[model samples]
Target: MPSSLARCVLSCALSAAALAIPVMSAQSAAAEVVPMPPHEKTFASPDGPTFVVGSEGESINKVPPLNASGTVREVFISGSSYTRSDAPSGGTLAVGYHVGCAVELQGGNVGVGPNAYLNPGLLDQEDIGPVVSINVGPGSVSDVPLLTKEVVSGVPARIMMRDIHLVVNGCIGPAVVRQYTLMQLHTDSLDDIGVVYGDPLWI
Candidate 1:
């Protein structure tokens, strides 16, 4: 019933509207399906140990024992601290960064010690539990200590580390003080060191 020009215009308008509907729907669907980034999602999920700041200002973390057949190939730690001393002779204080773990050996399951695991004395078949009391340098986080041999391996073991600060008093001057922060650890078995430090990506 419409004239030729009017009919042509109407048909074009209907076709344009039909095309726009699909585009709009697709856009809406995309918006609704927005996904979080991989790293963010991984951090949001609880797949490993949880760290909490202790009353003494140390970063304390507890991890479940490794699986039955799992083994730890390496251990590493890094951190930073600030030291102030008023004495004429600079006094040295040893701060312990503790890491405790269960070690499976020929005899039986035993707890790891500073000189026992990750050192030169023994080779643990499987390292489990928590390893603690590793010492870190003062005022810098750039140093990372990695241990390849004499570490626990092969069986299930829990792992734990505590951050610590040691301050030595200067005999001749004011008070000596040391503060440690931003401590972190890593191992071949666990790539996400941030989990040990309590921050997902190291704050």
Candidate 2:
């Protein structure tokens, strides 16, 4: 073959090889790891001490069930809570996730006071831990606590959960979840409650 024809054939072969290789774009690379934004809340009191709670975490959703009947997720959460009170009775902080399937969780009410569901004595021993497994159906929600520990006066209490497995079943639709950090402080005069809620995750 002529020299010019040979060069053209070489160039065409190089172009074909380049087209066969796969390339990943920046957005596609970023979509692999989703990070939840950090959230925090502070509660102020006139007669008692002020309190604060914060949460930051991430979740990885496994391949969706082929039938869309359920979902499996791996979640990581870190929570920080503290109080300025020096109450003789002390205080406690709990951190966890609230998972819902086909249900709206935003603006949901969190009851306070003695009869509230989040009251110190209301949560059973089986509900608090570093690892938890939850299953909920449509229109229902579940709170899974990853950590619950005492908070000392003027000291910060930090808690974390790493790659904990969360499985949801019997869902007609998708699953959405969020992180919650609850703190209850017992003062000389009254009880103070502080709560922090993270952004929602749809998996």
Candidate 3:
């Protein structure tokens, strides 16, 4: 990593330092606290769901509440996810720090994030057809392959999916990136915003 890129990565982590308040160690959370990351941001496009960098505090935008009519795409955080104070409709939350991750939802079923589904962070969805991993930014590991439970709309990068494993542990090498490239995850289900499960080894 160049001096400039390394600084960016460190700055990203700084945003989420507060959310480290504490870790939720239960299989399911009763009154979940959706901690915000220090960093807040969006992807290249502004139409689709915003790609929140590191959500340090609650959400800044309250538009299109959670589980609304239109579908929502976000990386699934185990303990907490895109939600506010209580109830799913309050507001959306993301860890903000270390880059905001997301999951693709079918619109109505806006249940808790993957942390609501599985306990162990890294779920290995097997027998996948070959998940395509693309980087949208720094510190992203597009390893696990995923499929959407709903039909993804819009262009490839903006599309989201279901039935895919969202991995966060990312590593980079001098050989892989020849330029200043951001990683993105994509597959047949969607275009640029692809979902793929990654390996623990990447950690």
Per-candidate clashes come to 31, 0, 40
Candidate maximizing TM-score:
2
Better of 1 and 3 by lDDT: 1
Candidate 3 overall lDDT versus native: 0.25
> For candidate 2, lDDT tens digit of each residue in 18-77?
765543333233233456777777777667566767766544544433343434433333
Model 2 ranges with Cα > 4 A deviation: 1-31, 57-89, 103-131
lDDT measured at residue 64 in model 2 versus the true structure, 0 to 100: 39
Off by over 4 Å in 3: 1-37, 45-50, 57-118, 122-203
Q: Candidate 1 lDDT, tens digit per residue, 1-203?
A: 89999999999999999999997776444322111111111121133432221112223221211231122212222232212222222221112222222311111112354345343212232353324222222222221221112112222122222221111111112111122222122233442222222132211
Candidate 3, residue 158: lDDT: 17
- lDDT tens string, model 3, 1-203? 56988998888787666444443322123223333233223343222332322211222111221232222222322211221111111111111112222322111111134324322222232223222222334433222212212222232211122222232222222112100112232332333331111111101
Residue 165 alpha-carbon offset, candidate 3, angstroms: 22
**TM-scores of all candidate predictions against the true structure:** 0.21, 0.60, 0.17
**How does candidate 2 fare on TM-score?**
0.60
Model 1 ranges with Cα > 4 A deviation:
32-50, 53-203
Cα lDDT of all candidates, in order? Answer: 0.27, 0.57, 0.25
Scored against the true structure, residue 49 in model 1 reaches a CA lDDT of 37
